[model samples]
Target: MTTPSPSPRLAGHLLVECLIAQGVKDVFGVPGESYLAVLDGFHVHADAIRFVVNRQEGGAAYMAEAVGKLTGKPGVCFVTRGPGATNASIGVHTAFQDSTPMVLFVGDVASDTRDREAFQEVDFSAFFGPSTKGMAKRVERIDDAARIPEAVARAFMTAQSGRPGPVVVVLPEDMLTQAVPDALKALPALNPPQAWSDPGSLRSLRQMLLQARQPLVVAGGSGWTPQATSALHRFAENWQLPVANAFRFQDLFDNRHPQYAGDMGLGTDPGLRRRVSEADLLLVIGARMGEATTAGYTLLDVPVPKQTLVHIHVDAAELGRVYQPALSIQASMANAAKSLEGLTAPPDVPWAEWTASAHADYLASLNGAAAAKVCEGTLDMAAIIRTLSETLPPDAVISNGAGNFATWLHRFFQYRSLSQGLKIQLAPTNGAMGYGVPAGIAAALTTGRPVVTLTGDGDFLMNGQELATAVQHGVKTHVVVLLNNSSYGTIRMHQERAYPTHVLASDLRNPDFCALAKAYGYEAEKIEETSGFAPALARAMARRGGTLIELTFDVQALTTRQTLSGIRDAKGH
Candidate 1:
């Protein structure tokens, strides 16, 4: 008697189960016509994968980035073909530049519909080629479904490997409907090679650092794991090296540490720039050295006497892509840091003198005109940041949406604890706005940790509708909305600087965000005075679920703790 064949549906179900085994719990996407089959599969396995439906494909991608940043895992975003895929590109690019691990799954038209001008047909691979680490299209045969697990493994491997980036997997409509045998469930997850730094490269890098009278280390991206961060701090401490975090990575180094220099961004401390330029050797690890991170890529042009640049990155393409490096080593940032630690003996240098000077400068800068600018108003950005820093639990995770508000957070906020338990997560580098709420939601849901997401009016409105998602999932997040009543405060700052009399497209009138949050079933409060801020935050945090605290401040009060050189440049200064 012939044996009965196993159901293909079960095979498809198992394929999804394998994904769960890989530790992917959160997915972002807006359901589309072409993705119904996968949606059905997802619904069948809803217990394993928690899908967060976003209002837009771009929003979904940003949400995925948020998850990646918070969990240090590959966040997944699903979308349909053509327009859906196109809309998701912004977030993918953000993930790529920021070195965030993410997977973008786009549903494709059926294989038969190729070149038929079918509904939602597009060259998805070509579209995602520039922004992703790897791309693949779906195959229909049951045996082809075997590749799904391997593909996902490879995608995640590439995403977290060299320089973390986004990966795209295009699924054809038929592939989701196709079934595989139950026996095919034993496929193993693909394990990518862990490429270590060569001894010679590590020796050379060490020699360069040792020989230089003034050496500096710059950290960026999400490549620095907890172990790596500890190793880095130890290395810096032992060798008496000064370290500066790129952009929002200040938490990577203890702000109270003597060797810690302020971050590099629009509001970068002038003293930090001076120290960076004075360094004889510049060691950049895991950082892309992107335009924004490098002050429009002009920081490299600063004259450094006897400058020797050593860049360690996972992605070979990023080694010398921005500022030309004297030595570029392609290896995992963690592995490279480990190798460097083994190779370099601690130097006998008075690092305290340099750090003390730098710290003094940073403190003076904070107390100077910048501080005055931040504290002029009753409800200033600096005060809010200080209050939050003082009030929040030491281990509370803070997520900020990209905007003028983030600039303030980056400059003023300091993480005191070096323990992994008190760390923070922000957008890698792409500085994508509208990710704060979703990321806070993911963090709260994944860890049951208290989360606060700070966003500006423009950014909140971008993906504000996701409030419903938070309420649906029972994730409690305290959202602090900075009501600036402007579309782009940074741009307006520039426009005002350039043409003060010319009222450009900078003004914006927005709806009452607190009322809107209440309408969406969140406990919402509007904060118009300083006295109400703490009570509102306390009430919001007391809630078992999501809450929105809308804080209205003078539009002119929106200023970054960092200097706004972008506006200066825009004004032809």
Candidate 2:
């Protein structure tokens, strides 16, 4: 009746074709038998897309998340079901809270054995259910070989859609080997849908700005390109507003700019917090104003802020999800920034003095305005951060995992503008530990730029094995590990306040990190004082391979502002 169907092709090979069609250059994951066909497909199309083998599922997922932050597309990661999927959930949660676009492919058990709960079988949808409290934005399973194109396309689109986040696609082991019609093809690459601010909303935003005597712009969140960041710079410059980046999104604005008002997060400047609370108008662009950025919801009143809020975000659902704003504009960050840049500013603004004062506060905070309260040992963290700020290239990619150790980096290291080249900061807003090493490796691999990761002794070990991935890939990344021989420094800081001198489960018996790095084929050194750090860093920067520098400090150096006992005394403990 009809011409014979073209020779069938393995669904795994077709899946790789779909990814290649979507312009994916690399896939990060661990090899597993459940997805052996997909692994073979990767080999078949190795020239089109490189498969990066990671030491663990979490590291693989983190690397994918970092790639998503850097590229504004869905960074893809593959893992087998059950433990692999559960292990990869950390990165998914990080991506969700950080608003980074990512796609995690979980190879599930064969369709026949799925409900039986066979070995390594898992129901991914329930595990990664999407909700305000859940980890992923969407979860789906591809049960048919012919529908691979549709599933893959939708997954990518869902990940990059409004309020970008991670999407989970479960692939059955049997489906990967199924033969599909050779004629079937992948859908074209999809671009993130851009929602533009309407003229009326833009007018309202302008009117609000005009009426305000003191206004502050909080900029941060994912989906920012160089062009968008440049537009944001122009918008800030045009209005002469003092801009404070939200939480971990420090590189969104050039910290060197006079209008830079510092970062808003843990260890926030007291002056900046005062300004946020006192500002007549809060023009929040891209930032969700989450608990961390709002100092656990203490800075800004919940449900309804005291300040006249003009909240512009990409997703409509996020507008009134927490604080009801005076004006809410649902538009992509790129479009919103572009529209704001187009809006003309008056010749003289009343908040000029206010803006100047905010910037001055930021500068003073940078100079250790509160350093007198804290006592340090052999090494000074602030000084080390300052050295990094001065030595690294303007476009160097800096990343860190969660820890009190990051406070120094956040406070002292000034980030260059993203317009310089790429997203320079890769810290997770979700406060995920063990994120820095894999993120740094991903940045170095994707951007081919100088990469530096800052981590604490505990944070580094979370995904420190990823160092092997970096060494195997021959990517250059300098890792600075703060050796205090403790895990949960942040928790310990709180413990000292809540229960003084009763530390338990926080102290760590750490290994010789220097020796571990050497074993991983990396140049390693241990620096006990501030002086040795600069020389070691210089040598690391000059080297051809990866490097790890360990800096030991006293436990009293808990945070950038206060010593460990200082917290205890404040609690009268």
Please tell me which predicted candidate would have the highest lDDT against the true structure. Answer: 2
Best by TM-score: 2
- Model 1: ten consecutive residues of lowest lDDT: 134-143
Residue runs of model 1 more than 4 Å from their true location after superposition: 10-14, 131-146, 302-306, 343-347, 368-370, 416-423, 561-573
CA shift of 481, model 2, Å: 3.7
Error of 1 at 344 (Å): 4.9
Evaluate all candidate structures by whole-model CA lDDT and list the values in order.
0.71, 0.89
Instruction: Give the runs in model 2 whose Cα sits over 4 Å from its true position.
Output: 1-5, 369-375
Give the clashing residue pairs of candidate 1, or none.
Answer: 98-429, 162-314, 267-562, 267-563
lDDT per residue for candidate 1 within 443-559, as digits (tens), equals 776667788888888888877887777777677655555555456776667666767546677678889777888888888877777678878787777778888887776555546
What lDDT score is found at residue 110 in candidate 2? 92
